[model samples]
Structure formats: C-alpha cells, structure tokens
Target chain A: MERKVVFAKPEALTDAPTHYCPGCTHGVVHRLIAEVIDKLGIREITIGIAPVGCAVLAYNYFNLDVAEAAHGRAPAMATGLKRVQPDKVVFTYQGDGDLAAIGTAEIVHAASRGENITTIFINNAVYGMTGGQMAPTTLPGQVTTSTPFGRDVKIAGYPLRVAELIATTSGAAYVVRRMVTKPATIASAKKAIKLAFQAQRAELGFSLVEILSSCPTNWGLNPREALEWVEENMAAYYPLGDYKVIDEVKSLK
Target chain B: MAKILMKGNEAIAEAAIRAGCQAYFGYPITPQTELLEYMSRRMVELGRVFLQAESELSAINMVYGAACAGARVMTSTSSPGFSLMQEGISYIVCSEVPAVVINVMRGGPGLGNIQPAQGDYFQMTKGGGHGDYNVIVLAPTTLQEAIDLTILAFDLADKYRSLVTIIADGMIGQIMEPVELPEIEPPQRPEQPWALTGAKGREKNIITSLYLGGLPLEKVNLRLQETLEEIKGNEVRYAEYMLEGAEIVVVAYGTAGRIAQTAIKEAREEGIPAGLFRPITMFPFPYDRLDEVAKGVEHLLVFELNAGQMLEDVHLATRDRLPIHFYGKMGGVVPSPAEVLAEIEKIASPQRGER
Candidate 1:
C-alpha cells in the first residue's frame, strides 16, 4: 500500500489551540476561511482585521498579516488598509455584534464608498464574548442573557437581515449568506468566502459573506442542538443564498 | 520660501502633506472643517489616500488601520468628535501605532458650542482614553507655530511610536496669519518591519493590544513607561517672554497663551512686572522650566479658556511653594486681552492679591 495523506489543516491556519466553546461552529467557519485563503494562494498577501469579539484573537490563529480592530470598526479598518496597500488582500472578520451593532455605520459607509475589500461576517444570534447577550440578529422569541424570558419583537425589535441589507448597497460587489453548521454547508461556506476574496482580487468593490454560525455556549444548548437550531430556525429567517453579485454593481467588474 | 497668508486650519493641513503624511481620514466638524476640506482636495490632487469618514469613530479606526499597514495617517476633530474618538485613541496608544490627531477644541462637556475654548487642556494632557498612558501633546498658539508643530507632529509621532496631538483653538483655526511653509521634500518612509504590510516571505506581523495574562500586560506597560520616560527627558518644550524680575507670571498655552502675552505687555507698562510662560508641549510639559520660573515669581497665575484645567500642571510644578491662582472663562467665551490684563493687575495689587 502507498503511503498518503488524505486530509490536513490548511496552511493559513496555525497549529494553535482554539478557545471556542465545544459546540460552537466558529472554528468550522475559521477553518473554511483558512482553506479558502490557502486554495486561492493568497495567504501571504492576506491581511485579516479581527473584530473585538469572541474571535478577537484571530490574529494569533491565522498565520497571516493580521490587525486587531476596535469593536464594530473592522470594515472601516479594512477600507483604510486596502486603500493604502491596494496590492494587499485586506479582509475583516466580524461577528454579529461587531457588524450589526456599533459597527453598522462603518459597514454601510464602506459599502457605500465601494471600498475594494472583503468582509467575513459571522452571524451568531447572541453576543458570545460577553456571555450571551442579545444581539441585533437575535431571532424573535430567542432567549439570551439580555432577553431572559424570550425576545419579543415589540420590545427587542426584529432581527436585521444583514445580507439583504448589504445586498441593497449599490457599491457592494457581492453579498452572500451561508450556513456552516453541517458538513455540506461548510463546503458551501468556503466557496462563498472564495468568491468574496475573488471579487477583491479583481479590484471589485466591497464584498461580504455572512455565515450563519452556532454559539452553543451562548444558546444554552449542546453543539449538536446548536446545529439543529440553525437548520430549523436560523436558516429560515436568514435564508442562505447569494443576495448580490458584481453583475448588479455598476462600478465593479 | 515665500510666506502665504492662510488660516490656521488650512496651514496645518498643508504642513502635514509636506511632512510626508500619505493618508488622511477625517470627518467634518466646525473650526477644523477646513482641515478636512483641504485634505480632501489636496489628497486627490496628489493621488494620496483621503477619506471623509461617516463619523469620527470610523475615521480614527481608519487611521489605525492605515498606520498599522505602514502609512503615515492622521485625523482632525473638535471637542465632541474628539470625545467619540477616545476608544480609538486608547487603542492607538496601546497598539503603539504612530498617528497625528489635531483637536480644534470647542467648548465641551457635551455638544458644546463650536466657538473656541481651551476646555480640552486636561483631556489632551492627562490622557482622555482609559489607561495609564500619555500622548505627546503639542500646544500651538500662533498659526506659524501651528504649521511648524503640525509638521513636527508627524515626525515625532513616528520617531517615538506614539500619537501626537496638535491642540489648537477656534481662535487660531479661523484667523488668518502669514506663514512661511517649510521647503523640504517629503521623505519616503523606509519600510518598517514592524508594520503589517503582508506576510510574504517573512513572519506575520500583528498589530494588537491584547495582553491576556497580567504578567504579559505588566511587561508591555513597563516597556511603555520606559518609552514615556525617554520622551519626558528629551521632549519638553516651552517659551518664556519677559520673565526677568517678574513678580507674577501668567501661565497659559494655545490661544490663552497668545492673549496672555498682550496682557503681560500692558501690565509691564503699568509697572506690575508680569511675564508670560507658555507651554509648547502640553504633555512632558516644561515642568522643570516652570519650576525654575515658579521660584522667582510671587504668584503663578494660570489663565485658560476653560474653568482652570491647566492650573493642575502649574500647581504640580509649583508644589504649593508658590501660590497659584486660576482665572478662566468657559462655555465658548474667550476672555479678551484686557480681561487677562485686569486679572494680572489684580494679582499685583496689595489689597486684591491676598492669599
């Protein structure tokens, strides 16, 4: 029999211990991004701007040029990095709280300005780092530390369809939403990240892929239940699909 | 170089471009709005990076990103806008990224008037953001000094790996003065190995402030302290006028300092023997010089556009050995030269200048 290695970690991902909770799917999404960067042969040129949330230590895990950004300001940060160093592939890895809350203005403006960059948005309904506070994307009737009884649309407001919102921006080159809970979805999520990076490689305008992620610790469920919750609940509200592409953008290729 | 008549705000902007700042991220706010507008036009003409951010919060972070990527970047704001940037400022200092910030201070505690006020003296010198850190603050009074300091700000910031503040007031910002711009080619910054350009053919570079363990944080803080001590030793700057045989010295900076000079002259003609001691650098302030001056004066009168903020530094330098009196005008009301003169005259009077 010939010796062969069938599977291995992506070169972009460092051999570092992850700090994610047992059932959380952030590690899966991280791997998907790493694999995408590796396959594109862009690991050396990629500069990742990590947000101020659970993946704040993304710089440590990703074996590439990385910069830590203040909460919700990664998109704006990416814009600066990309604009100054157009040769460098700049991207921002932001969570729901970082993208939809305080950073909403940054993303909207970056997209509006048509910055040449990529954004990986992790849509976990709760604030994972602060111990499960209700996030802007928290589903209606979802319970978290901030919404003890359950989130009522009347009191807590409805969840923002971030993918759809970003899709509406004329400067957005590509906008997508994908799930990473299941193995099949993980492959698709990786594809989405690749397309987003590809758009940037072509000097396209802002590209974003919102990944529906699982925060089992914050959701008060096992990792298995979190995946099930995404299949049954999250996927329905934030239907996974390509919302926008370069064809619709006038300035981008 | 031919002297050009320019507003303080526009002069600072032109000086920054001449000083080799490649990128500028700013939001429009009064008093300093011209700074952003000038950069907007000049950057486009020069093919440099310029962006009018949606807000001050985004602007500072943009500077943060550009600076980490090995570009000299800057931003400008007023009081409320500067307050919004506290978090980013804290991060910048902690991450040790070199950036230049120009605060054309307006009256503040909140949404205060756009008129000039030196209310931000304490905010600028004593570290507005959270942490045990200090930024090298250069308080420029004259438009010429504003131009000179703005140019020096970029160099000193990069040289020390720290943020440098150009604290100007609306009085200086809106006024026109003749300034001889320095004629020097903007030197291209050599590659900084520490900056995160890319990981190609080299180890990855990370621009981060997170020190998880206390031991690591302690080490980082100690290193920062060491840098600060070096700055304190060599970077102190100030200017004194007519300090010889003075009974009272008016300690002021920026616009207030400019006004104090007029007051001191009138007081001198009145035979009051008053002089002006102005701090050129707010942080790493000319404390030793002020102490030297404090020993000769009977009273150190601190005048400001705020309710006695820089009085704290004057007190620290004098250390109660000398009596310090604070005279301030707040809420966008800048005292006239006569008002300051009266304060000096009152301090010299036997019946009025009592302890």
Candidate 2:
C-alpha cells in the first residue's frame, strides 16, 4: 500500500539548520516567510535584506538572493534594491532594536517616500543577539540586562507602537500587528505577511507587518510559557489588529 | 562634446551621468550641493534613480544597495556629510561592491567652516572607517581634471568591485572652468557573479561584510589586501613639471598642487630651479616616483591647505634621505602664490643655518 505525505518543509527554505534557540519564535516567523514565498512562487525573484540582529544570519536559511544591511539600515537598503530592480520583490526582516530604535529614521522616511517594498518587523521586546538588553519596545516594567532593576517608565520612556506610528504615514498602504501564540493566530500572521507582499507586488506602496515574537531565552521561560506570555502580556499592550489598510490594498484580495 | 563653462560641482554631476551611473543618492551639503542639485534634475530627466536621502548615512547605504544589484551608483557630499558616511563606506568596501563617492571637502574637526581644505587626506587615503581596508582616492587639481576623473572613477570602481572617491576641495567645487565633456559611454562591466539580482537559474548570491570566525575574517582581509596590492601596482598616477635640472621639487595635490604650479613658475623666473610633482592618486601616493624625484632634487617641499596632512606620506616616501620642508595654511586660509614663492626663496637663500 502507498502512503501520502501529510506535510513537508517549504520549498523556499534551504536545507540548512537554523541557529535560533530552542524556544525562540524567530524560527517560526522564518518558516512563515518561507511558506509565503513558496505560496506566491516568487522564490526565484525575491530578495531578502537581513538586519543586524539574531536574524542577521537569515540569509543562510532563505533560498533566495539576500543582502545583509548594517544595524538599522535595512529599510534604506531595501529601498535601493527595489528601486534598481522594480520587477523584483524585496523585503527586509528586522528585529525590534534594529527597526524601532537605531533605524527609526530610515523606516519613517522609507514609509514616507511610499517606497514599494515589504518589511517584516520582529518585536520581541529585547535585543536577543546582544544577550537580552532593554529595547525601545521593552515593556514598562520589564527587566533586562540594561534595565536590571525593572524598567522605569520615567527613565526609559514607554514602549513604542511601531505599527500605529507607521500607519500614520500617508505612503504606507498596509500596516498590521499580529502575534503567533496559537495555531489560529499563527494562521492570521501568515495571512498578514502574504498581504504585505501582495501589496508590494501590486505596486500600491509601502507595507509592513510587525510580529510580536517570543524570546524564550531572554524572557526566562520555556517555549510553552513564552507563547502564553505573548498571548497574555504582549497582545494586550500591542493590541493585535490592522492599523492601516489603504483602499487599494484592501481590494488586493 | 563642445567645451562648456561649468562649475566644478556641476561638472562632476554631468560626468557621472555620462558614465552610465544608474543610481545616485545624496544629501545637500556645502560646495557639493550643486552636484546633488544638478543630479536631481538631470537624473529624473534621464529616467535614472535619483534620491535625496535624509542624510549621508542613508545616501551611502542606498548606494551600497544599488551596487549590490550590479548597478552603477554614486553619492556626493562634503566633510561633515562624509563623516556620517564612513560606516556605510566601510561596509560597501568590505562587501566588494562597486560604488563611487565624491567628497568636495570643507574645513572640519567639528562643524568647521565651509571653506576648501584638505584636512581629510589622512581619512581618505588610510581607511577612514574602522577596518583594515583601503579606498581608491583620486584628487583632481582643476575642473577639467575633476570631470575626467569622475568618469574614470566609475570605470575603476567596476573593474575592481571597490570604492573610489573623488577628493576635491571647496575651491575646486565652486570654481567655473571651460571643460570638454566626454562622450556618453557606458562602462563595460565585468561579469558580476555575486550581485543580488534574484537567484533565477542560479544559486543564491549573498553580499555581506560579516565573517563571524577569526579564520574566516582573516581570509576576507587577506583577499582585500591582495586587491589593494594590485591597485597600487596598476593605478599609481602623477604629473611632473620641469624635473630634469631642478634643485627643488614641490610636492602637492588638488588645490594645493595647482597653487604650487604658480609658485614654482615664479621660482624658475628667479633662477631658483624649482619644479612641481603633483600626485593624482592620493591612496597610491606616487611613492616610487616621489622617491626617484627626491634622488635628484636638493629639497622636497610639501604644500597643502591643511596642517601638513600629506606631509606624513612624504616623510614615508623619502624616509629622511632628503630634507623635507612643509608650508601649510589652516582653517580655510588659502595661501597666495606670492606667499608660497617667498617660502621657496627662504629655502634657496644663503642663510645656510636658517633651516
């Protein structure tokens, strides 16, 4: 008797092992992006820009042309790549510290210019590659290496809402925030990622999807508890929803 | 094309356009502002990529991206703006992508005034950013030379997959001179197997400067040093005037070199036997030729707009074999030809102990 294969790896992923920690959700998001690339059949013509965070080595896992940008310059790099090759689909995968802190100016300006590119922002509330430091998106009372005494809102300021801030830019055609705590939320996050790429394919404008990811090692929790932490702690503060969807992007589906 | 009177900054812009620069990114800065302004209008008309980035940091990173796509790209800025671009420049060089940068330099240690100065000589020639790498730096003495070198810079950058900088001063940027523009000829680029232009029918290409391990990083550094060696051997350029029977040779570059020409001519009129040796490639330094010239001349006089920045290179070239004299003006004060001639006279006079 012959048996049918139930599931397999995405065709867009290379046959290389990832360097992510055991409970890190970075692997989950990477797999989601690879699946989206496979679903759209754009692996041959898609280019990825990796930022200077844990995902800096993302180029090794994605089976497509990739360029590694400096700490916070991925958005600017993506703009250059897209402008020079208008037919190709270009995207940047950046972490919280890379996209929200040092690269704030670059992201804001890229969105303002209405550059036709996609960005997948990973907001894990801490700088993972640098060994758990207080990021711009760190929770008010969160503790990390830099904020060892628990974050003081008066000293470090509030956590930034990147999706809402980017949605305010007229150039951004689609901006959404989603988390992957459960199977249903994971499916929704994939849908948002697909939509962001679809918007770029249609040449509508800038599009972004900020994913509230889990950093189990930094958060000091097991993989199961980390998912629960994102559901109970991150979702309430972030408010998962679509922050910006232009009429053109809304009609994409 | 016919000889057209153009400002130095605008000529650099027009020259880059004719060289088939597919993309240009830059910000507004003194002296070099005209280059970006001219590119804004012409690149749009020519249907090329032209973006006025938020800062030099963004501009250079944009250029890096275009270069990684195998597109001929360039950026222009002044001293302060160039400082902001150092990190991007280091990354571009290490990634081995072809890109051009034009620094129409102005005075600076801080927000120093916007007057022509060569204070960036050390920065331009000897790896300004944090790394063990070198950039090909071309210094032009006149507007015409600036235009010619601007075109050559793009070709050299493509040939070596390296960064090429055109170092001009504020005087060169602001001056207007009649120059014969070259014909529009796109550079014949070599096969860029490493470009990030989609991996269709090929293996994925990755352009990155990151090498995590010591051995891997050392291998990258060795390859970079090998390329620098080849450039040093093949691209050392200089100009000599009346070195045959000269007792003194004036060493200079860019605006200072041009000023030295007038001073040398005055010294020759006074039977001082002074000639000029001007370097065209600042990084290559013309050490061999300068040393050969030192063998025959009695004195080597280094003239510059900064506080003897190139004097260090002169020292290394002659290695204390010949007496080296330096004359410099700081903080944007350009010395007149007469002033330089007086220094030449002092060296020539019979006050043997005055040295």
Tell me, by lDDT, which candidate is best: 2
After superposition, which runs of candidate 1 have C-alpha atoms over 4 Å from their true positions?
A: A1-4, A248-253, B188-191, B351-355
Candidate 1's error at A167, in angstroms?
A: 0.6
Expressed as tens digits, the lDDT of each residue in B94-208 for candidate 1 is: 9988999999999887888989998888788899999889899999989999998998898888888889999998998899999999976866555588888889899999999
* Interface Cα root-mean-square deviation for all models: 0.7, 0.5
Ten contiguous residues minimizing lDDT sum, candidate 1 chain A? A244-253
| Candidate 1 CAPRI classification by DockQ | high
- Between which residue pairs do clashes occur in model 1? none
lDDT by residue for model 1 over A1-253, one digit each (tens)?
A: 9989889999999999999889888888888889889989999999999999999999989999999998899988888888899998999999999999989999998988889998999998999999999999999999999999899999999999999998999889999999987778988888888888888888778999999989888898888998999989999999999899877343432
Worst 10 residues of 2 chain B by lDDT: B346-355
**Clash count per candidate:** 0, 0
List chain B TM-scores, each candidate. Answer: 0.97, 0.98
